[model samples]
Target: MVGPIGNKFAPIGDPGRQAYEDSLQVFEEVIQAACQQVGIEPVRADQIAVAGEITDQVFRHLIEDDVVIADVSGGNPNVMYELGLRHTTGKLTIQIGEFGQLPFDVNTIRTIQFSRSPRGLIDARNQLERALQVGLLEGPDLLAVTRIFREAQEGAADIELSTPDVTVETSDDDAPGLLDTMDDVERRLAAMADNADEIAAAIEIIGAVTESAGSEVQKAAQSGASNSVRLSLVAKYASDIREPVEKLESQSSEFAEHMESINDGVLALLKMIQSSSPEDRPEGWEAFLDQLISMAESSREGMEGLNTFGSAAEGLGSLSRQLRGPGRKINAAVNNMRKAIATIDSWDRAARSIRKPSEV
Candidate 1:
């Protein structure tokens, strides 16, 4: 299918006009070559009809055709959705993409990757011919497709399995007894609570800094600085401070939710340990065990949220430093903030580990 490459090409904007035209020209040539390679007479028209009706036409053709070749080079959402519909109909579908342009979700799929060069196009045509011989007439080989998918999944599994496990040692003499471990967990929970408070304080500080910087920019503009100079200063201020402020605002609710989940988990773990006994045990050891399980679950969720926040914070800091230019006090300050966030992430992980209960 062709045309309506992407929304970026929907309007005749200066940035994309030439590139869009070039891509369409290339796509038409590729399709013509593909048709000939499969022993089908190439459509006489060099140009494929480009209009709103193309999508409907393609869908109807897909329903009738024994095989469908989809070009997903531009990552067009509409094309991807239509391709998905083709898959649902159980037709033999061959996916093709430009080199280095595949979407993450379908990167593992058995796709024909092609470069934009003449040699690459020839190679892709040959491959498509072979695929058509095997795929179209045979009505799609389920076993081959299954094997391709299984290998991809197994490669991902292998990466997870290869990750090194972390082990912590305790002294045999002053080894952390159950009680000691429990105490440590409590201390870590308290520290996490303190860290959450610190995050809130840092956000407030960032807001204040932004406000002060804005005021300074206004004064600089009014102090007879050139309009160009004032504009540059304002841009720098936005580039340096806006992201951190925005990110802090965006993540506030998420951070609060994570902290609340962690707090609840810690409290439940403490109660479970405190109420344990040989007889007349806690009313619901099984239920209490479930709470411990939830503790791990919630801790993981909270950590993931924090990790996201950390990444945002790091990007904000990096952008801030870049805006401030080199060898400046503001650049140094942003770098320090980045390092502080990194340290917080490390300490947060350690705290969570300490709070995690031993497996029964």
Candidate 2:
């Protein structure tokens, strides 16, 4: 199955020793049973080619395998790209995903749903076994869901597949045409639009909260509240802001991971495009690379801002711990308030740095 395999994708618990164990269990049990139902031995991308580079092996499997089962949990980019490659071949492909983690691009496609629980796992295995049997005998109905596969099957009969690179060569009479390219571009644009909307909405909400907190602070100061009371109010505001900052930081990290994957994809595309004739290359390819570079730089800047805020918060915490005595408790509280404001401000700056792609 095409999915993440490392510890980083592992579910949390068991002091981290059981990293990826649950995922492995699900895959080994369900996929093996599915293969048995189809009366075939299961062969994964990793197992087929033991000596070559991992990606090359994966590409070979994507093209040569009679049927592919993709586990698309976490929306892992490598898996998605491989799934795309498999779809382009017009081969039998089945997609499975955790209940809620499937990406938007693949959400409309029919996928066998799985979960982490024991009952869910049992159901998933049974469902996959049936799906596999049907797919092996009659092929799957996923063609309509993936425009790429449908276009390839209709417009490009007999796709060429080679080792180390799964390239599609078409004849003059029945070239896959621009529809497939346009569809890919549309999906990329949609994914970006969704991410931008989410980031914009999150930043707007955070900004509104910060503004309200500032107003309250100002009002409290003018009302002659005691320093202790004002400190307490600020502390509460700081605590509230921390949750969103943490969330934004998590989003930023995920964004960085996704962009790294995009960078790899862009590099691969550039190599492939350069290998082809100038006429075959997509228009404005360099411009596309430039846009990616600009976004990468902005992402780097945002990550740096998060690191800075983290350092500052750690320093403030250290300072607060160093302070002793009842008199210094208010001082510690003030420092915490300052640290929270700094963190919120840092997040706002980070948000600004991660501006819309159109802005770049």
- Model 1 ranges off by over 4 Å: 2-19, 41-55, 142-360
Q: Tell me the deviation in Å of residue 150 in model 2.
A: 6.8
| TM-scores, one per candidate | 0.36, 0.40
Model 1: ten consecutive residues of lowest lDDT = 157-166
CA RMSD (A), model 1 = 17.7
Deviation of model 2 at 62, angstroms: 0.3
**Which tens-of-lDDT digit does each residue in 287-341 have in candidate 1?**
4344334433443433333332332332333344444332133223332333233
How many clashes in each structure?
A: 0, 0
State the lDDT of candidate 2 residue by residue for 1-360, as single tens digits: 677565634356653325356447757878777678768777765456588688887788888888788888777788898888887777788788777777755643456667788787777777677667656776754343255357665786432211225564557775434444434543553454344344445445556665786798789889998977767776665665555554554444444334333432443354455455657767765455444444434433333333323323322332233212211232222223222222223322332333345744
